[model samples]
Target: MTPADMPSVNARAGAAVEALRAASTELKIGVARGTSGETVIDAGGREVGSIAAGVKIAEICMGGLGDVRLIASTATPRWPWTVQVHSAHPVVACLASQYAGWRLAHGEGKGAFFALGSGPARALARKEALFEELGYRDSADTATLVLEAPRPPPAEVVERVARDCGIAPERLNIVFAATQSMAGGVQVVARVLEVALHKAHELKFPLERIVEGMGAAPLPPPHPDFVTAMGRTNDAIIYAGRVHLYVSGAAADARELAERLPSTGSRDYGRPFADVFRHYKGDFYAIDPMLFSPAQVVVTALESGESFHAGQVNLDLLDASFT
Candidate 1:
């Protein structure tokens, strides 16, 4: 081929080199030696390159990852976020309150919203420094549980005290104290006795004799429906096991102590004085540890109208006292 007709080597090579340099700069490539000779490849910052043997350096330099360009469209966009703290315990509630307190102290946002009546709620209220001194805006507080009834500290009261403190009666959230006895004990054991009677019947024992043995003597012909209803609730998760029993009472020497009773499918009838204690440990989360023996906790879970089966337990509602 004539020199004039053939492409000019220097001009073609120069043009190719210039094009490569422009593309390499855009790709942020660095010079590196490969099979044929030195060539331009990936920048070697965050990416690596592989080339075929005998290939010319110019050929390998021809391709690279495209430049990354950030596009600008909207100047500002709105983003919204929210938070929730779900807890029935005073301690956990307290932690959430402190978190809110920190946010308020910083004045980070427009305003703070919170659910009141967790232990933390009371703790936050008690912080006179925040409200009285610093003047933090008070957030609305809602009571989770409240109760009202007319009764003196008990007929056996020595001195009377006002139920309401500095807090307004309307603002005050109240929960009933389980009845206290003359001995300062509230024994809710009648249900346990009734359960045992029903179980005795299922075990093929005489229902009448079992009922008579369980305090039927005092009442003049007690309602049979009461016994039947008790039996049904017991059967339907009021107790564990097809034949589970719950024994409880603070009476130190009750003849029907749990320890003396036979073992149940879901309980340890010895050592712990109540079947509820056994249930509490077996299904810990289903019962509040602070208010019940693991056993009592379990019993409460069973007594809970909610349905639960083996290996599944409820998230637990704290006893009114704790929450």
Candidate 2:
């Protein structure tokens, strides 16, 4: 492992799960061992997950390489509740761990189970092409994965995960949170910085140049309807999420990055994400990949001590989506 990645993402995430398990009841999350012996965490599916639970879950999703927090900000009074996120290791924390790039599937047809796994376990699984680019791998006696499914995964799937992660099922933990749950909203909204890092990577900006990063986005109320809830959480970022990146690069490069990093650059920028999803017939791949970034940004060129700004908050779109 690289010096910056010394601790190993899985090891850090394992520490987080231990803490989550210790305070499961206070966090209002359901914790139980599956038949296969893997620990299952119900952040919202079986129990009403709280915002505090979401914050901790978000941190775990980053492989505990980052910090996630909640605060009330007059910065956007109309959407007062917000989630703030930061990481000293942006590339490792956001892409290697939190990007939800793992495609896990079991069975066939209607009975098939599928979820894009996130969190620290991905570092150990090395399932995505992303890990190749990262050139980093980790091993831990314990593993933790965060899933957005509405219910516990099949025991077969959990066993597969443990095997892939090279750990005993008893040493693995799976965290489940549905998009419509309150805790779910916080976890999704907390991806503001991860979204920025992802877009920056997509933009082909130098990941090594990203020295430090921070982001914030409004936390919308979770909707009972899955589509609306997903829309609100996504719109919270695409309409008002803000990010600041400290990069070690030339001013021109920084300015170019700032201009292209915001959601406004996408053809699908103006509408709520749910409408965009319907327009594309529910195929996420059909939407412009550029649409997944924060709405506002500041990219600083550390070499030149200059910062470039781009994008703006669309309160109208925010209100339309939230209400």
Candidate 3:
């Protein structure tokens, strides 16, 4: 398909930008203009990232392909926001995850920064394996990215991003959220379902067969320390997240896929992510690849209307990790 025929992540995310800026005060977020003239929305960096801001960030992450809702959680009252996501365009939404997901690392040294760069700009870069597999690309004059960081990117970083997206710096829009803050937590937890879809893709499932997807996870309280924050966000998915996918493939294939989709399929399944992180000595790539999946997954084959389920939520592990 042509670029014009495809959905634009920047265009969809841009709609939320105005609303986010308008409610900056109510959402406890700060908006600023970068030296490179890019628009920057601060979630947990210089300002406190509110639940509302997190919701907006999550929407941006999905390229607005899906709906994100903040619901009350009876399971974890302390972490009140239960993030729920639903998408009719499952493949497109998953493409959004690949294009703009927080999978990239940027900058260098103490002056360096790490960001899960999301939005349509990734298609322009086409640097990752997922992008190559999707056989998709996007073209737009303006680029949008959601960065998980504690501070606004440096001028050079902004310029680099614009360059990478093949756009002028002034045309870039970057949103920032730190992992150790409320906005960061909400945005990260929001990916519980997306992560599962990505895993299915990794396992070589026919992504186009997925017609609908929905997922939910408890929002963990934000932490000031990055490691602790990472742990909590991961535990939310590994121990408590649940996902359901409606697919148009064979029931047996869907069932087989479900059996291999959850975090329990990995060797690193039993511990809090922090401990696992330490065990791997902070090399994210060294961790069990399968451990990145959701705690539970259910797939319904549209052809036969049969539901196949796998994995289980380990509440004990969640409590241990959260505490």
- In candidate 1, where is summed lDDT lowest over 10 consecutive residues? 214-223
Task: Give the clashing residue pairs of candidate 3, or none.
Answer: 100-118, 100-119, 102-116
Q: Which residues of candidate 1, in runs, are more than 4 Å off?
A: 1-169, 175-323
Give the winner by TM-score: 1 or 2.
2
Runs in model 3 lying further than 4 Å from the true structure? 1-5, 74-80, 98-108
User: How many clashes does each candidate structure show, in the order listed?
Assistant: 9, 0, 3
Residue 139 accuracy (lDDT) in model 1: 30
- Root-mean-square deviation of every model: 34.9, 1.3, 2.2
Residue 153 lDDT, candidate 3, scale 0-100: 76
lDDT of 1 by residue, 136-200 (tens): 22232321110111111121110111111122223322211111211001001112222333333
Could you tell me the TM-score of candidate 2? 0.97
Model 2, which residues run further than 4 Å from truth? 1-5, 108-110
TM-score of each: 0.17, 0.97, 0.93
Count of clashing pairs, candidate 2: 0
Better of 2 and 3 by lDDT: 2
Q: How many pairs in model 1 have backbone atoms within 3 A of each other, for residues 3 or more apart or on separate chains, i.e. clashes?
A: 9
